[model samples]
Target: MKLRIAILGTRGIPNHYGGFEHISEYVSTGLVRRGHEVSVYNSHNHPYKDDNWNGVSIIHCYDPEYFLGPAGQFVYDLNCIRDARKRNFDVIIVMGYTSSSVWGSMYPKNSAIITNMDGLEWKRSKYSKPVQNFLKYAERLAVKYSQYYVSDSMVIKQYLARKYAVNSRYIPYGADTITPAEREQITPHEARKEDYFLLMARMEPENNIETILEGYNQSNSEKPFQVLGSTDNRFGKYIAHKFKNDSRIEFKGSIYDTAKVRALQNNSYLYFHGHSVGGTNPSLLEAMASEALIAAHNNPFNQAVLSKDAYYFSSPAEVKELVETVQRRDTEKLMVSNNVQKIKNLFSWESVVDGYEQYAMECYLDFNNGKIIS
Candidate 1:
């Protein structure tokens, strides 16, 4: 059935930032193609200033995050909620509860609110204890106020079910599968194809950037370890300083060009994912889709996605072992083939978009029938 849907959260999309923006771009465009009206809330200062993005309406809201810091997100979310309350959308899918849950009571009753409760924000090591406590409260508010919840990982889904006694639909982020031809065209100048180890993640303490580098430094491997992402943050600077003298680590800051990222992933000897805190991370999935052999942090969230398909590591010593001893070009080829097939079957954008549409419609119908909606 046709519906008027609004997507709020994230800076805005043609995706200049993280996972939510990437999801917003694909989901909104997919719904528009399916003949539903979709509007995404954009920040007034978003790089993409266009009113319409791939047939989806863009509503620019005032964002003071640039000047006011973290406090500005609350204002931006308040602006989004106040404006959305006037739109009378059939389904309003909020991406995350970080800032918006505080204003949850102001959300329009006419819209069926479905919140994607992202990985436990309170668990991030970067947040102060007070901020972490507030995140926990925000999560509770989201659970109490929204009509439905969306979990991007099975681990997250189980957590919500057990802790909050809340039922949630599981919908993962999707990625593009890279072909041999596409992979060949966008090689980074710093590394040869399949010769360098790669680690690409935002430079945050929770992502284990330092741990990964330490392990690589300890190992005797001759190939350079290419690190792709911005090191502008304090944690990143510290990591850089600690590993500055090591000639084996190449810190290539923040590669935003999709082609370059895909090329790096497809060509890497091994892709290290050190994220210990998120649900199904988009970067991990993207690496899987690119057919990169993975060495991910050993955690429930990572295990749920990679299963037996990846090599797991929890400590620098384990990462060192993987770097030093893991060999067999034939075995790596088989693993890459398996990951490629898995991404094609389960993590495609088309399937992810369909799951979102189904969930939104189910909640919309429930709201219309005056059943099970808050």
Candidate 2:
């Protein structure tokens, strides 16, 4: 059966940046290939020459850059969701509920709502109380209203079941950008042929870029660090200045070339993940795909994702010690890469999207069969 669906959130198909955008690109492409009708609503700022790509209808997000960050983007997304409803879509795949959930909740009738609740956005550390509360309102609205929510990690799934009383389906992250061939293509110099570790993130306070950089500084200073990230917020700038003083800490701001990051990851001795917030980060999964020994922050989300396998660091002392140990460990290296290889295969874009497409198709099939949905 052909399914009419619209994906809403963080720009649209032909993704420019951001994790969810890539997801929309890959998932919609997968759906299109599976003989389903798919349309992706993208941000107006998202650049793409044609509105249609290989049978997938790409809808412009309607003035994305016009919006000043989330406040502006939230309004843009609400319009997209409303437009999606007007199109009489079979299912609306909502990504980034923090922005679009409020509008999604108001859509009447039993539309199959499948939300990719990427993470607990409201609980992030940097946002103010009111801002956080507003996000919480939006988050819960999406959770309570959507027919189904895709929890990317068991940790978040458990949170949903216990806290929201909503039974979410667990669909972990997958890598769409990085491939084994891509990894092999990375040059040693680009991967910091010199002595260094790799860290890439959004330069957000909650991601703990500072903590990791500071921790690295305190550690053996012989090794340099390569941070492939873009700074859009105050915290990012602050950390950049603090670390700029150290020639050893090379902050290559906002690298759009993922291949470069992957190349770096391929040749690096380790990948430093300091994110204290969010669930199932795409960068983490991608880094894991490179199969480098990972030293991540000791959060249950990170721990659960890496499963009893990844190294942990909560402070400078811990980071220093663990980095030293991990760089030297023959077993740790093999274990992390092997585990990443194992999990990532199951979570590969092909597998994850197939699961999503099947689940989505099942929901639609059930709806048509009068077996599921109210």
Candidate 3:
């Protein structure tokens, strides 16, 4: 329909690094291909300005300290809303509800604003009291101000329904397409390191990383476990050193390269996801896409994703038991292969972008109908 759209929190898209980035890239590019005029508001640190990345316009905003992390998100996103105010976009999609969504919420009924609420920041135990309180307030503001909210997991939607009384539709993170030949060559069965277990995640306390290490250390199995992700934090490094004597565990540090991470995923004997917070994590989705025999923390969000296909653990004993049980289950491998096909078919880039594309069309029509966009 040649609709004009602008995206905030533009660090995502162009497949930069994280899950949201991959999603943004897919959806934004899909819109561009669908004949919509799209522009992503990016930071100055990004290498390009006003360039066509996958048919989408790239608008670079010059925010000096925006890259500093959580706090700076508000500053840059405020700039996005300010600049977008002068444009003719029919819809403005923002991410990280507290970051760009909050910026759009502050604006009047100028644009149809849709916010993607990826995680529950209020549940994290690491933030200070003041910050946590501020996050809770921001969550309210985001819901109150935006026209609609998109949640990636059912758990998150339920949390919002209970906590903020908002309804969030479940649109999970999409999975990449791995060709049969590629999958065959990359399988753990082909690799000599196939016997090793795998854990991939960003280093954080609430992720229950400490317990995962302790469980691995207690394991009587001779097979080594591969740990991927940065452990720059004091506690993360301390845990690493404590388990240093156990040659069964090896920390590979932060792997920014998706291809390398995928290879590891495709090569692992099994996958371990210990995230205790957030909903519909990208790393977990990617792990499933790689067809890893899985053992995840027993949480509603993880359960929703696995859907009775993978193993779940609540404690160290449970994790060890599930891992061993998965070792003997040939039927579980068949289910993973089947689920891999399902994930590819249902969560592909085409399907995901089509969903977002429909949402944009609806928002555009609502704006044209003189509806009050929150």
Error of 2 at 10 (Å): 3.1
Model 2, 1-374: lDDT tens digits are: 77887777767667687788877888888889998888887777766857898788988767644647657877787778767766778877888687777776565355677888878888887889998999888888887777778888888888988988877878776784456667766565665552578888887777777778887887775777888777656887888778777888887787777776776776777778888777788788887777666788989888877876678888878877865655546677667657667655666888888878877887777666667432
The TM-score measured for candidate 2 stands at: 0.91
- Candidate 1 segments exceeding 4 Å error: 187-191
Model 2 worst lDDT run, 10 consecutive residues: 186-195
Candidate 2: pairs in clash: 12-42, 42-61, 191-264, 229-254
**Candidate with the greatest lDDT versus the true structure:** 1
Give the TM-score (vs. native) of candidate 3. Answer: 0.91
- Relative to the true structure, how large is the alpha-carbon lDDT of every model? 0.90, 0.76, 0.75
* Candidate ranking (lDDT, best to worst): 1, 2, 3
For every model shown, the clashing-pair count is 1, 4, 1
Off by over 4 Å in 3: 66-70, 101-105, 180-190, 370-374
